[model samples]
Target chain A: MEKQQTDKRAAIMQAAMELIAEQGFHGTPTSQIAQRAGIGVGTIYRYFKDKDALIEVIHENVHGTFISTFTESYDPQLPVRENYLRIFSTLTRLFIANPYEIKFIEQFYNSPYGIAKKRADEIECDKPLFAFFGQGIQQQVVKDLPFEILLGLSLGPVLFLVRDHQNGFVNLNDQLIADIVSASWDAVKR
Target chain B: MEKQQTDKRAAIMQAAMELIAEQGFHGTPTSQIAQRAGIGVGTIYRYFKDKDALIEVIHENVHGTFISTFTESYDPQLPVRENYLRIFSTLTRLFIANPYEIKFIEQFYNSPYGIAKKRADEIECDKPLFAFFGQGIQQQVVKDLPFEILLGLSLGPVLFLVRDHQNGFVNLNDQLIADIVSASWDAVKR
Candidate 1:
């Protein structure tokens, strides 16, 4: 794509992300998304074949952004605890800062589109988190448990806590975050 | 209600559960549920004010079943660890035993219905679990963390693992369950 078209596509994606985050996939209309993007409906077609294709790209983009954010913060040379803490803290802060991304992920994970995407895609997303946990287990720094079990013990709570905070069921504070991190660390510490 | 009426209601709920589990809320119509129950379409209206009411009933049924199952096996006099172990194990086994119930819950939790239901409902939903955690925290048997956080740390893993197992992303063996319970205990232990 040319420079102008690339910018236009970016604009469309941002618009789609905003609308879908607010109204969900089924509730969103392509024309409304185009209007929000400041582009003609036909221009959307030029960038993507259909709404499903557009959604597919958006899902990939969101997942990719999460991976990049996590992978960037991770330092293998650092002590295992610091490295894992970096992964958790960076991802949690980014998620809180970008409610749109969080909303997009929550909605996608709940919908049939998200369910089908998981089944269709063989490649495991969040490979970086797994690698960190894998290293921790191998080094005997973390609990000698399966990677999946470790994730469920740690990130599982983080996921629920973020959701809880988002839904006004619980208040989030630095102290609470500290407590959670402490508990989560204990959960996997050897 | 008469015995026959009670039987009919149970039949309607079972039918609704099956269809909703298979096709989700939007895809399954009341008429289809009625047909599957071998009852008249008018009978559904007679029982439920609307589809939403029926769904609300289903949610209550599933939750009620979970609570009863947990409570039946619970002995308040047992050690805190034993009490919690029963909870984690009972809930996981129930979820695994009833794939339909799990599907119903996953779909419901991912919808506006689930979010709204959480807000509207009081603290009574998980009373047994809460009582156990409250006592543990009180006695300093568990960490002085919030009951909600402990739940998120413990049950959260069980929920994710069950969902993952259902999706065939991970296998749920006894050893994995034991490992998760151990980690969860570690997460909440003083």
Candidate 2:
């Protein structure tokens, strides 16, 4: 019974993700989400309190999957440069594999809901990804600037290029990917 | 009469920009824009055929402003380092000054409408700004990599940092800005 419940919840979330990713939150209505999920509208409330709650869950799932899947092989004991490249490559692969998630994330980050949460959490939210930056700084391998600046200059290039690629602005060939990794390393490395 | 027309158009565009920036296009309605502009709804039709046309105009205006204002003092005759620094600083300052436009632009680029037009123009979108990269390559001061790769590696950092600052995820400072420009130049410079 518990497994079935979990399955049902995942199904609903998947439906919401696809709908939100395609039509955006404003464009996708609750009834439409219910229809897409092959469930009744009332069933959605059983799993999520409302549309906003559902979206929040989607945010959690998307971010959770990224952290868990991307860092599954991350070993903190590695040298700074290796770990840094690992992180960059993992992110590039993640976005490349799931272009829809990038779109969903962009919408979430720019929306009022996402903005409020991000502002409240960004300064204090030092996830494992950020800890990598800290480790680099301790090893004298990364620039000694503020953490946010470090994040921006190093990871920003990859982030922007991936989004550009997803939007069909630039092609992400292997050579370009290699260059981007090297450039991002130079941006933050001492 | 011409001056009045221009002023009214500007007011409408400004209203639409603020609305679209704050809320995604799907979430913003034309009536709300009309009300915000303090004009009759019919007046919007006089200037714009529809919401899509208005948004296209906004795209053109935003890109035009960035290119024109940022390049106002750009001189190819300057040393490679000097010209590169100038370009970076100018872009940083412009985005910082107009946070609203940046938000609007992010929303625009991510939207379906924006994506369609951007993909169509992106291959041929090389402007004077991109020419700076070409010049650097010619002088052997920049990497000999593909120009698109050069762009992604260099300016992508600034683009990300400024957005982070606007989102309250990062605080921009003179020292940090200096570090960023140096790192970006390092990424591209030979």
Candidate 3:
């Protein structure tokens, strides 16, 4: 019974994400999510107290997925450049697979919703990626710039590439991604 | 008479920008801009047919200021590193002096007003900067990557620095700016 309930809850969350991505948080109604998931509205209520609760769950799930993907593939024992390449490549793949999640996270970060969480929880959630970057600094493989600045240096180009792709300003070919990754590494690696 | 008209137009544009920055486009009214400029509302309408026209004027003025600052100080004859450093320093100073303009531009870029402009006008407005960068690539002084990718690599760190400063996440000291510039240049320059 517990397993069945969990599966139903997962289905509801998945449906909610799709609806939210389609129509935004304010535009999506609980009834629509329930209908889309083939579950009763009461079942969604049992899993999430309200729309806000559902959104939080979705946010946490996306963040968790990003963290786990990095941690699972990251090898602390590897050379710094190779480790960075792994993290970057993994993140690019994850983002490609979950464009909606990327949009959701970016929108949330730019909105007032991002500030209510405890800084500790936020940091803890991001610790894996941060630790990988921190390792680079310790090994003197990256510049001694602040971790966030280094991160922006390494990640911002790809973000722009993604943005350009979305805007139809540029095409996203493997050659472009390779150039971005190489240029990014060349910029920061000591 | 022409000089006096130019002065009045400049005052009106300045007033409109101030109002727009403070209250956003939807929140600001023409009467408030007139009052701020110590001109009658009729005078504003004489120069600008409507609020949208006023916004266009502001956009053009701001773009002009930015382009002039960038090109006037940019020496294409210099080595790539020196030329980049000069332009970066000039831009940093401009951003520091007019942070609100920077914010306004960013907000405007993400708004419908900016979207209504044609791609040709947008490219024409930014052509000087693009030409400088293209020259760097042609001279083999910078990375031989896609122009947009190279641009993102070069400028992405500065955007992060500005964001950190605006959010009070970090201080914008000379040392910090220098380090960021050096690090970013290291990433892209050949």
Candidate 4:
């Protein structure tokens, strides 16, 4: 019974994530999510207090997964550059594998919900990644820029390339990913 | 009479843009747009065929304005590096000046509408910019990567920084803009 309950919750999240990613949040309805999940609307309510709560949980789950993947084998003793590469490449692979999650993240960050959450300080910064950047800057291994700017410089092109890849404009094979990641390093390195 | 008609049309477009930028497309109703414009709901239909048509027209207008601004004083006779700096700085300035339009664009490109347009090749690539990239590659001044990859490397960081600036995470003054643009160039240049 516990297993069944967990499966149903997973089903609800999967359905909601797919719908919200494909359509803007406002475009998707809770009823539609329930329909897509092959469960009753009330079942969704049992799992989540409301649509907002459901979306928030989805965000936490997805973001947590991303953070875990990149930080799994991360070693603080490694060269900052090596640590940076590991984080970037691992995160990129995760994004490539999970296209829908990527789409949902893009939508969430650009939506009013995201804006409000950010303003309220609810969406905490990824501390591990930020700490890595700080250490690199202090070591004079990276540019002397704000953390936000560094984050943008590091991940901006990557996100753009991922979009292009998802759109069928480019195929990000292993070689290309390596090359691009190297170039991204150049963008931030002093 | 014609001048009044133009003003009304402009008013409707302005209202729609603002609402859509704040709320996702499905979240915004045409009636709300009309109310915000201080005009009748019917007035919007008179100017635009429907919401989709209105959105398309807005995309074209915003994109056209961006192209015109960057390409206005563009001199192909200049070095590839110079032209790139000019284009990047100009576009960055425009994005800074028009927060609503930038939000609209970010939302649009990540939405189904933007995806569909891209798939259908309806969203034409900017020719002049492409030509510049091509020229740089041929001259061995830039990395010999795919144009799409080059584009991501060039504009990805800029867009990300713009978002950070909009969210008050960073203040993108002229100096930082110049530095980021230079870093972007570094990512693409040989």
In the order shown, the candidates' DockQ scores are 0.56, 0.66, 0.33, 0.74
Runs off by more than 4 Å, candidate 1: A1-12, A29-46, A119-123, B1-12, B29-47
Clashes of each: 0, 0, 1, 0
Native-referenced TM-scores of chain A, all candidate models: 0.85, 0.86, 0.83, 0.90
Among the numbered candidates, top TM-score falls to 4
lDDT (Cα, tens digit) per residue for candidate 3, span B1-190: 9998888888988887876665556546788888988899899988888888888878877877887887788886888788888777677768767866776565455444464463554577457768877888888888877676766776766776676577555677888777777777877788
Best by DockQ: 4
**Which pairs clash in model 1?**
none
Give the lDDT of residue B145 in candidate 1: 80
Please state the error at residue A75 of candidate 2 in Å: 3.0
Best by lDDT: 4
Cα miss at A171, model 3 (Å)?
1.7
Which ranges of candidate 2 are over 4 A from the true structure? A1-5, A39-43, A70-74, A120-125, A173-175, B121-125
lDDT string for model 2 (B1-190, tens) is 9999999899999999999888878778889999999899999999999888998999889877876776675898999899888878777878888987888888887776677767555544456657878888888888888776777776788888898887667788776777788888888888
**Better-scoring candidate (lDDT), 2 or 4:** 4
The 10 consecutive residues of candidate 3 chain B with the worst lDDT sum are: B110-119
Docking class of 4: medium
Q: Write the per-residue lDDT of candidate 3 for residues A69-179, one digit (tens) a residue.
A: 867888888888988777776676677668778766654454345545534444675577678778888988888788767777777777766755655567767677767
Q: What are the per-residue Cα lDDT tens digits for candidate 1 across A44-162?
A: 99999998888789889988787677678989899889876767766667777787888877667666657767754423554766778888888898998877778777778888878
